[model samples]
Structure formats: structure tokens, C-alpha cells
Target: MARPLSPKLSPSIIAQAALDAVDHDGEFTIQGIAKKLKVSPSSLYNHIDSKADVIELMRGQVMGRMDLSGVDSESADWAGSLRIIALHYRNAYALNPRLLPLVTAYSVRDATTIGMYNLMAQTLRTAGFDSTRQLEIITVIDNFVLGSALDAGAPDNVWAPGEAASPELRAALDAGLGAPDRAQKSFEFGLGLLLEGLAREAEVLG
Candidate 1:
């Protein structure tokens, strides 16, 4: 019998199956993905070596959603470039908040994800950040973006101080919590603060 024109499974298919599982169940297993794909668990090994490989593929799927090429390292507007990249990164993860923990647990070996980092590094290098500072800046941005992404999935009432709440804390939550696009507004506000500080640091480094 002749084999089918298209192979039975591809990396993208496997990754998407696992991602679907994660999206619904908050985790995935090789067997689970195989069942989802209507294939035996052993067949999954033909396309993926281990769970880490599937995680990387899922990472790539998320990262592929962002268009990083729009970042203009040559423009010398490092803050602008960084902001664009950060927003893109945060938005991508916001779609799959459950995947965030898994991706963070594993070492990032996904080419697309690494490419996004490379663009950010290039933007920093172009703006006069030294190699040491580049990594630090990238890490800071990564932490902030991930935290903000998690916030996107936060409950409408992120904090419920109730009777225990101080007047100031209660007032703050009353004004901000449950606000429309609260998470996005907060992320932008925080991003602005970070960019301002980094801009000052860049000036001092010059």
C-alpha cells in the first residue's frame, strides 16, 4: 500500500494538540496528546523526542504570533523598539496564561522565542547598553512582561481586602479593580515607568 501524500503527523500538529490540552486542562501528557490526535502514544515519539521538545514547540507557537520584524533596531529609538517588543511579548503570553509557567520552567530553546530576544538585545546594543547591562535589561523586561501577562488572567477582583483593608488600599482598589482593561492599563503604566528608568540609565552610560 502506498503511504499517504501527507505524513500522519507533524510537529505543528503535535504541538497544537498539546497546547489545546494545556489550554483546557492546564497541563499535557504525551499520551494525552496522542489520544487527542487519534494516534498511539508511541507514534508521538517519531516526531518529538520528549516532553521538553513539545514544550519548545508550544513556546514557538506562542512566540510565532508576534511580528518581531517590526522592531527597528537601526532607528536608534531603543525605548520605542523595546516597548513594541514588550507589548507584543505580553500580548502573546496573555493568550495562553496557562502555558507561561510551563514555558518558564523549561530552558527556552525555541528558535522563534530566541529570535525575539535577539531583537531586543540588538535594540539595546544599538542604544549603547554594554553586554552585561544588555542581559540585565532583558531579564528585567522578561520578568515584567511575564508578570503582566499573568495579571491579564487575574480575577476581576484581584484583591479583596474587605474589613481588613486600610482606607488607602480600599480606595485604590475601588478606583482601579474591575476597571475595564485594568490589566492592560496597569501593564502600560508599569512599562512606561520601566522605560523611563532605562532611558535615564542609557543617558548616564553615555
Candidate 2:
């Protein structure tokens, strides 16, 4: 008798299955992925050593798709470069915001994602940032991008004020309540704020 021709599993296959699981449930495990793929847990183990490996692959899958259309690693317009990168970075995670927490918890050893960081670091260093400041700037960008992803994941009308809420708070919510593309507008505004503030600090600390 001939054996059934099952789809062969590889690291990318495993990563894709795991990504689907995480996207649906906000978590995944080797067993969960195996069940999703209709494969044995042992089969998954054959391709990935641990959950961390699977998550790293998923990260690459997402980051690899970033639309870095205007990024210039050699451009002197570091600020413009930052804006372009931040937009792409936020958009990438917004696709699967559920995976953001997992991606942050794991160390980023993936070359594709590291490429973005390398550009940011190089841009800052070129602008006269010391190593320590470069790290801080990187952290700031990471935090903002992650928070932006979270914001994108949040349901529309994330804030609701009750009778006890202050008129000021209620009015503030009204201004933004049901606004079009609220998360996107906020992210763009916040990115500009961060970049401007960081540019000033870089000069001050230079």
C-alpha cells in the first residue's frame, strides 16, 4: 500500500501554523500547533526545538513583510527615516497584535527584524548619539511601537466614561470618540512627538 502524501513540514510551515494559532487565541504551544496542523506533536518537535524557536520564526514572518519603501540606511535625513520605519513597524505588528507580547518577551535574534534596528541604531549613531543614548532611543522607539500595536488592537471606543467621570474626561472622550482611524491618527501624532522630543534631547545631550 502507498503511504498518504501529507504536506511535508518545515520550519516555515511550523511557524505559519503557530502564527495562525497565536493570531486566533493569543497563545500557542507545540501541542496546540500540532493539533492545528493535524500532525503529531512529535512531528512538530522534529522541526522546532522549543516554543521560542517557533515564536522567533513567526516574528521573522511578520517583520519580513514590512514595507520599507522609503528607508535609506545611508540617508542623512535620520528623522524622515525614523518616520518611515515607525509607520512600517507599527503596521507590521498591527496585523497580528496578539503576538506582540510574545515577540517582546523573547530575545530578538532574528536577522530580518534586526535589520530594522540596525538602521535605527546606525542613524542615531551618525547623528552623534553615544552608545548608551542609542540604546535609550531604541528602547523609546520599541516602547512606542509596541504601545501603538496595542492601541491598534484595542476595540473601538476603548474608553467609556460613566456619570462619575469628570466633565473634562467626558469631553475629551467625545472629541476622539468614534473618530475615523483613531488609532492610526494617534500613532502618527505620537510618533512625531517622540521624534521631535528625541531630536531635541540628542542635541542637548550631544
- Best prediction by TM-score: 1
Relative to the unseen true structure, what is the Cα RMSD of model 2?
Answer: 1.7
- Candidate 2, residues 109-177, lDDT tens digits: the string is 888898889988888876778899889988998899989988888888788657977989898888887
The lDDT of model 1 is 0.91
Please give the lDDT score for candidate 2: 0.85
Q: What does candidate 1's lDDT look like per residue over 1-206, in tens digits?
A: 98545437988898888899999999999999988788888889988899999999999999999987777886778899999999999999998899988999999999999998888888999889999999999999999999999999889989987799999999899888899799999999999999999999889988
Q: For each candidate, C-alpha RMSD in Å?
A: 2.0, 1.7
Question: Any runs in candidate 1 off by more than 4 Å, and if so which?
Answer: 1-7
Per-model TM against the reference: 0.94, 0.92
Model 2 scores a TM of: 0.92
Looking at candidate 2, the ten consecutive residues that score lowest on lDDT are 68-77
* C-alpha RMSD of candidate 1: 2.0
Residue 119 lDDT (model 2): 86
- Model 2 spans > 4 angstroms off: 204-206
Pairs in steric clash, model 1:
none
